[model samples]
Target: MFDRLFFVLGETFTALRRNLGLAFAATGTVAASLYLLGGLFLAYSGISRYADGLSGRFEMRVFLKDGITVPQIKWTAEKIRSFEGVRQVNWIPRDKAWEKYSKENPEIARGLENPFPDSFKVILSDLKKGDEVSERIAKLPATDPDGGVQYLRDEQNLIAQAKDALKVLGGMVGGLLATIAAVLIFNAIRLTVLSRRIEIRIMKLVGASYATVYTPFLLEGAIQGALGGLVAAGLLALTHRTIGEALKSFSALSQLPSLPYNDLTLALSGAGAFYGVVCSAAALYRLQLRYR
Candidate 1:
């Protein structure tokens, strides 16, 4: 196995050396393409996390009228259960509400009479629709006259805007990266096939099968993919660190989550290698048909 591995690698490098300029350019193109893809994915993950965190802060509290009986509360809740975009409608009984309030404001809990109200904490399917959902809940008769639906109306609107911005950025950047990857990989492999055309003909005359002829070029492509992937991973790590540091300088942005470098490195590198190998096989097979 080791002998075969070394032989394949030796032939691969020889092929690479034959077209050093093209090989290097191809590899760099692949690295740059993957780098852009990795950066976009990182931004996608960060924005998604931020949106989730913001949504977590929003829970529509439907405060009940003081005299509404427990049965009346259950009926009101049953109505809300069927409301659109309502994922979870939990009843926060008066005792539970008091417990939560007491922990947060122990002084207030000590001096105050039973000031906590019975409420339903509504978790929506999408927090971006908080305003609409809150509006619907406000009309219910059981809601407290003094306090109806409570939620962060403005923040939900902001989350919706952020989501829109992310969608636009992803579509544009992702499409460009895909185009560059396809063009560069196919062109690179075709150039490799062109460079080795003479050698392939010579091998065919010496009784070499297509398997033997194809192995060296395929191996070269796999190597190109690995090198490109690792280089791109390094570039992505550097960019992540630099940007993370810059963002950390602002206290408002300090909560931004860090990228999982190890996981991303493996994922991106594997994708790059797979692209190279597949492209190499396709280009070589086309060349074989042409030369036959």
Candidate 2:
């Protein structure tokens, strides 16, 4: 077994050396493909974190009608508090609301009556139940008929749509690059097999098993893939560090979550190796040995 392993290793290296240009091309393609995929993963992760952060701060505003009485306001607040997932209900009287509005928009608030409605700022424990909570609050007797319960539903929907679009676009691009890489790997292995056809036939005639004949090519492809993955990982790490440093001066950008570099490296490397082995196997399968 040890001798066969040694032979496989030697043959693998020999073939790689003999087809250096093709091997390089295949490895480079694999690196580029995996790098692109890794970048997408990082970007998606960051966007997801940002979305979660925004969702955590989501608040529903229940606006009371203009002629709403104090008793009606109290009953409305009590009913909202009884709702599932309701965390806190803070009252914002029209006077205080108007004060804040005036401070923020002095020009607009000048010489205008307090147009702000008395409202309840409803905080939720679970963002997923936002729509349910909003619907219940909107049906309350004191809720304003014009604009009753308001939340960041439109903003949330936009974020969700953006995430979905990113996933679709990433999948399409990643798949195309992966297919190109696989084809390059297949062609590289095929060229190596063709170059050593005479030696392969002689080995077959000397009673070499299929495993003995094919193991070297398989290992060669794996090596190429692994090298490519390592290169891509290095590039990703460098980019992450550089961008992180550049964004440090921007407070908002710095708050974005960091990528899991260790996990990403392992995933990329393992995926590349597996992809390479599959492509090599495909090439060998298509070039079935008639000598056997």
Which candidate wins on lDDT? Answer: 2
Instruction: Please write out the lDDT profile of model 1 over residues 139-208, one tens digit for every residue.
Output: 8899986767888888778777776776677678756765666566667677766776787678777866
Candidate 2 structure quality by residue, lDDT tens digits, 106-205: 9999999998889999887656578788888888788987778889987766777777877887899888988899999999999999999887988898
Number of backbone collisions per candidate, in order?
0, 0
lDDT of each: 0.76, 0.85
Candidate 2: residue 223 Cα off by (Å): 1.9
> Model 2, residue 277: what's the lDDT?
92
Candidate 2 local accuracy as lDDT? Answer: 0.85
Local lDDT at 267 for model 2: 84
Worst 10 residues of 2 by lDDT: 251-260
**Poorest 10 consecutive residues by lDDT, candidate 1:** 283-292
Write down the TM-score for model 1.
Answer: 0.79
lDDT, model 1: 0.76
